[model samples]
Target: MAETDAAPSIALPPRQTDGWQMLAAIERVLEAERDQLALWVPVGFGAGIAGWFALPGPTGWIGLGIAAAGVGLAALLFGGTSRLGRAVTIFALAMLLGLVAIWTKADWVAAPRIDRPKVVALTGIVEAAEPRPATATIRLLIAPDTGNGLPPRVRINVDAEDLPAPPPAGSRVAVRARLLPPAPPMVPGGYDFARVAWFERIGATGRALDPPVIVAPDGGSSLADIRTRLTAHIEASIKDAGEGGIAASFVTGDQGGIPEDDNEALRRAGLAHLLSVSGLHVTAVVGAVMLLTIRLLALSRRLALHAPLPLIAAGAGALAGIGYTLLTGSEVPTVRSCIAALLVLGGIALGREAITLRLVAAGALIVLVFWPEALAGPSFQLSFAAIAALVAFHEHPKVAAFAARRDEGIVLGGARILLMLLASGVVIEAALSPIALFHFHKAGLYGAAANIVAIPLTTFVVMPAEAIALALDLVGLGAPIWWLVGKALGLLLWIAHVVADAPGSVANLPSMPRGAFALMATGGLWIVLWRTRLRRWGVVPLAMGAIWSLLTPPPDILVTGDGRHVAVRDGRDGIAILRDRAGDYVRDVLGEASGVEGEAPALELMPFARCSADLCAVDVSGGGRTIRLLATRSRDFVDIRAMTRACAAADIVVSDRRLPRTCHPRWLKADAPFLRSTGGLAIRIGSGEVESVAEQVGLHPWGSFAAGSR
Candidate 1:
């Protein structure tokens, strides 16, 4: 070899057409992403879980068969030397694992559900209790006694007046409550409480007929009691309900005490994350502990010289994170943050980079393996997406290089930090907006700006003050710290209010099409996961998704699953409902679905509608088409002859009762039975033609009321 070192004898392949060139390019791209292979596992796994949820009904054996096939395929590919083969095998296995995991979890958590409304006397342990100011009710998680003919768990709310305070968890209690199956979505493409209840093993929900009588008082100091007591202590210390509620939520994750107005304000201001103990809160706790431990240890020179400071600090941080997670009730967000925090600590102990995209992937994978159903929830999606965006933004070559530069002075350094925070906020907002819109149909326009002030205030001032105050309260000397916490929270609340009150601060839109959301999500992931130049192509889909979303037409008419409330879109970008005096819950849901930020006006009040005690006729101008609609104002019967004539002239007819056969609408007949089967209805009309009819409920466990019927 030394005799000539034949200039790396290279064999040139023969030139080929565009097809071969494209294949070669793809292979090159795959090679470039070799280091990123692990990052794709959670994606594939989540896709499988999503597929399982998208199925119309349960298919346990099919999932198992698919997983088995994957195992076999992986085995076959194990012998292959090709990188592509290895990648495919790994992805296939991950997908199958996800499918099997969710299926198994679903089967395991399956429990009997209330088939219909019933009032029964039951005694059970109080697993949890929460206050509901809006409803003037106090909710309790009841763990039924054995052989009660009830599911393992049921939740019922008693009148706030009936009890002095919420019963402590673990207290055995008896109550006569009217139990009903979990409520399905009130509007098309709305939140599904039934599905959530099914997974949590909550068979029924209702209001108590009488107050719960405590059979056995809870005297033991358990974790649940600790949380309850801490919440009570915080609420007692702070006289202001709003501040105290926010403070309690920060420490104990008991958000029940927060007033509805304050909660709405926080959500609109985009500062709502502070109320939830997630990555920010967890990191604050861990970092504070680590800093204190390092400082305290450094004071001891002899011990400091002999001890591994980073490893010791990491261990302390890990412990603090775990304790905080448990204290906060181990919510999905908290659990994910704790998992990520532990991963970071492990990395530190191993002398590796502590934060990276791979860290997010590992945490998500761990959660999916254990609770696969979480993959379908907004909490999981938002949590992981936000973290991944931050990591990816900082990992960019230019950004990382700039961030690594040494600052000449404190002012410059502080400025640099502020700039980075602002930039990170923007990136996070961009990544999370699509998800928020998909789930909630609303996105905060100024969340990034609001976060710049709120996040630092919370992480630095509020959390530390609260933690110290909590510690001092144990010794009855946290008055000053509590004051500081209140002041800091007040500032945060002020910032939120300012941002939320700004005109156009929030973009409320109709529910986005599933296709558009999926496209955006995929594009966002591509941009976050890949480091290659090819990632720029993700913008194409992002743009396409935005266009698709913008093109989606809002429904001209909305009918609740119960047919008790109805809304029709006016020619202007507003909606008018059947009942002008609809309850807050109904009005709010209807408004959001119709892209109206606040209360929608009554159809009778609109110029295009006429209403009476029992009937309402509407003329909706949708896309230059005047859609005639008739709906009942109440369940009271109308003259059959009159109803038939009105319905025959209308494009859509909706009522709470069955309609006569003589009454036929040209477009749709959304009566009680139809609404019951569909859950909710959203109808769009264009140019005198029925454009689309979207139903809220699908063949899912939560919405399938007929299943397990009594």
Candidate 2:
């Protein structure tokens, strides 16, 4: 309406809004990120090609053909496709190749791995255990018992009979058993336990149920004896400090002295990861070392304010981290942490301002290329996912806005530390949740709360105190350090107990299928690695897969029996009965185990009654009644019969154990405790687990595994 409304020329500014800039920034990152798919393609081809020969039987030929097809397809795409087309094609093919390799490898599983059950002569060192009478796991280096070439080392799950007195980690022992590679679970999508054990250089695993017939012939001079002596010395020093055994475990991953109840409490609380001696622990050391090194550098004028000094400190931190990894015996988690750390350090050295997702992919590729079996391992999956998330997408401006607003202290120094920890936890825990749910079926709600205090305390106090105590012991000033160490240990134990006992402490979820987990993981990768927002939204596919499982249609082939009993019913809560403890494993395939992956299942451990009522809140199935029991138990205890009949009026009778002579009910003893239904995979949600605690009891028998104990 004014003078020039129609004719005024409007100035068109450049389309460079903050959002555009961010999009552009993302594009630049995509461009700068070297084509990891290109790399992954070649690596996959090689593994498939070479492994073709190493792999057993006809599947190798099938794999070879797939490799050829992939190569041909890759070439055609390279010759004619656009940049986007080629990148997408390469990624697709590489992923497909990886999937094929996974399935093919599963086919390669073999039985009768160890030569025979025997009492053979062997020599090796015990890799670890707290020195106290309560807990320890000893590894023995195995040889022909008379060979010049190095002998393969094996880890033996030792027990009370292995030694007159319990030994610390690294004690050399001579013992024997029927040694064989542990068998992976026979069920589809179950954990590949044996293969993982193999990667850690263990050829055979068996119980050290009986002690060596004789002590070392040359006690002081033998290498095994020497290691034992050194380990014992450390043990004595720790004992002298008068700290209870829990501290010993935190620092050493040896749970020899912790009471079983305390261990159980910690496991329930989700605070058990503190004792694992993995990345978290290494990071604590790194934090302390970095602080010390930076302070030292600051004292020297030449070092102060120099970017090079910071770089050097990072490098030094890497070395220290590696040393710890070695001392900790190169556990899978530690190895992954060390590898990831160095790669990050290298990026820093190269003057890189950003960490690309490709770096994470590259690191994972390197580890997998060498240890392909690790693809199935928990550490490998969890570590890489967490690292990938942290390295690339952990803190986006969008996600971090809330965080910034919450920080009222001007990003003060302490606040910065807290922020770093919280962010790291969110990234890593989110990345691990699906897998954890798939595996153990429970989530640790209190993990963050526990770690908030645990991380800082370990970083500033516990770790440093440990180092000081160790250093002092080398001289003669260990007593005071011991007292401090004891206090720290007590703090950790108390934290474990408190966290474990929290209400809503352990919610159970269901176990998800492996395929579903892989889909979710791929979705995360797509989200992080793809530059285009629309493409990244491919996470919707994974999310959909997860949700689909939550609404999994109930199964049709319901086996409500152990070996002895069989009852078929519509898949619903309180459906099956197991007789023998061994039967639980089998039952799990057909039904839910003790719930807690995501949406808790209703499976219970056997040899008890009133199971279904305890597992579910509402009976989805109409009330129908079935009761099965062993005659002996029925006659001996009227309570047993009453309890069986009261399985919330379940309409099934499957007896896997010996059927009651009068009841004549068919039952199965094997039950599935490893799975969940109607949702996600059940993970070992809390810190420590019953299995870990049970294993520890062999070394430290102070606690109870008494009958009917939880």
Candidate 3:
């Protein structure tokens, strides 16, 4: 009876909310925006390529097969069924395509492995010549020479003082040299020089024992000849080596000519991007050409009325981009920029949007498909990050609001542009900071400020001036233009010096973990790609990455790949480097990783250490852990005996020579055999644990070949 009276009011738990509704909302949004979201295909494909590279050895092939099968199954199950099904299918297909791309590129660029170091007479045609401030390096494409088992390409370093002139590109040369496989990372979790070499088809690096003898005169293609002549002319035009080097770099992308100190200055000031041939350079050149073409077409009434002006202008821009790419030697960055420029021009020619996310995606996809290995390189990462960030930021509502304001006058308009430049620079620096940290272990704190001043000057003055000068030089009328370029370069150099000299211009940070970087990158991409308020979620991963990077523990000891240098972390968070001789590269890598600037002093090189002629003993205490380390540079029996005596009481022993059998348990041999296998070793003193570069990277074909042999 009571229930009958109240059959009325059964509330059913007030219709409790379910988590599935939120997911349903997401699905609805994704379905409605499938076309816009499809841009992620190339991104996912690139990620899959990176994954393939990260996989261990032949397991990559297995992973590829699995992905391909999954894609096929997905397509079979959901072909044209629903939006969600299509999205899943697209994802699987993209991953499969990525793996296929990686496999194809790897196979296409594969070179014969070098088994051992050998002194041989090498005869090959020089592909390129990069003259460093301290040495001259020639890139030689082997001509199936008989004596040595050199790979397709080798980089040979000749003493600059002894060899006054480097062999020009396309010149056949003969040289006596000791050829070794490309050097691996200097420390665990460091740069992978071997991987870079593999992708570049450079199988080995060598030091020339004698000056190269030119077997034939330069016989390069017309494009190469022109580029060489242009570079030579620019270098000869400017008297100062630094200025000339900067001019050449801007025009031809030959950075090797710049001095190390100058390069460091640029890096510290965050102007190093200007040295690379990238989107900025290509855009400047293409824009100038397009503007000129449009103006010329406008002058002709018939052409303006009847002809497709935009198409003609776009064609001119495309030609300019092609020329610039060829001038820059078609480096990866240049190629990427050229592709993007061409895509944008093609869109203009077709009456579509000139610049859009699709254009960027297409360019990225092309690079990924052709050179999947570039996904690992800093230049590729930084270039894409900068452009993507710029595009995303400019497309944002806030940026649009700022840009919509009418130009009051030249003064106000200039101010607005300056503000926009500052904003864009900030956005780019923020986007690239994680990548730079992950790769270089450092960030330029004042990058935004430096870029604000540098970008406008470089884009409007330096690049355009250089391009004009290049054109004029073909007609022997480039002297004045060259002077103008030199002036702009001088100003750029001055800006670099001034900015880099500022206190705290460079921020040295320990390397960020790969997982943390991946997390941050995902969030960054989300923020850039998503068109909803949910994009704010990206901040969470970004903050988490920053915290993770700050908290990452620095290695207690860093051993160089060559086994000749060891950096031990001291109690004061300082580094004590133990070495028979100084190595700037090793010092810089260790310093950046440990957050130390410049070089560790001689006293700090082996603090609290007792050293004999060949052996050095040190006790390192830090983070509530003590480690007894004994290092010896000599393989002499006397030094070995001293090392053995010390090893009995030591927790770790690093030696250039093999240790005695008694010391085997605690020994980390830095000999050729040990380094060949391990590349480099980073030891955690407290746990007596080790991280090997070779082991962490696993047994890839390229790295394994070098690691397997002495």
Per TM-score, the best of the predicted structures is 1
lDDT of each residue in 246-356, candidate 1, tens digit only: 989988988887888888878887777778789999999999999999989989998799999878988999999999999889989999999999999999999899999
Per-prediction TM-score? 0.93, 0.66, 0.91
Descending-TM-score candidate ranking: 1, 3, 2
Cα lDDT tens digits for candidate 2, 432-485: 677666665555666666777766777678778877877888888877877777
**Leading candidate by lDDT:** 1
* Model 2 lDDT, full chain set: 0.51
lDDT agreement with native, every candidate: 0.82, 0.51, 0.77
What does the lDDT read for residue 2 in candidate 1?
A: 54
The model with the greater TM-score, 1 or 2, is 1
Candidate 3: worst-modelled 10 consecutive residues by lDDT:
133-142
The alpha-carbon lDDT assigned to residue 8 of candidate 1 equals 70
lDDT of 3 by residue, 86-117 (tens): 77677777877887888788778888756668
Clashing pairs in 3: none
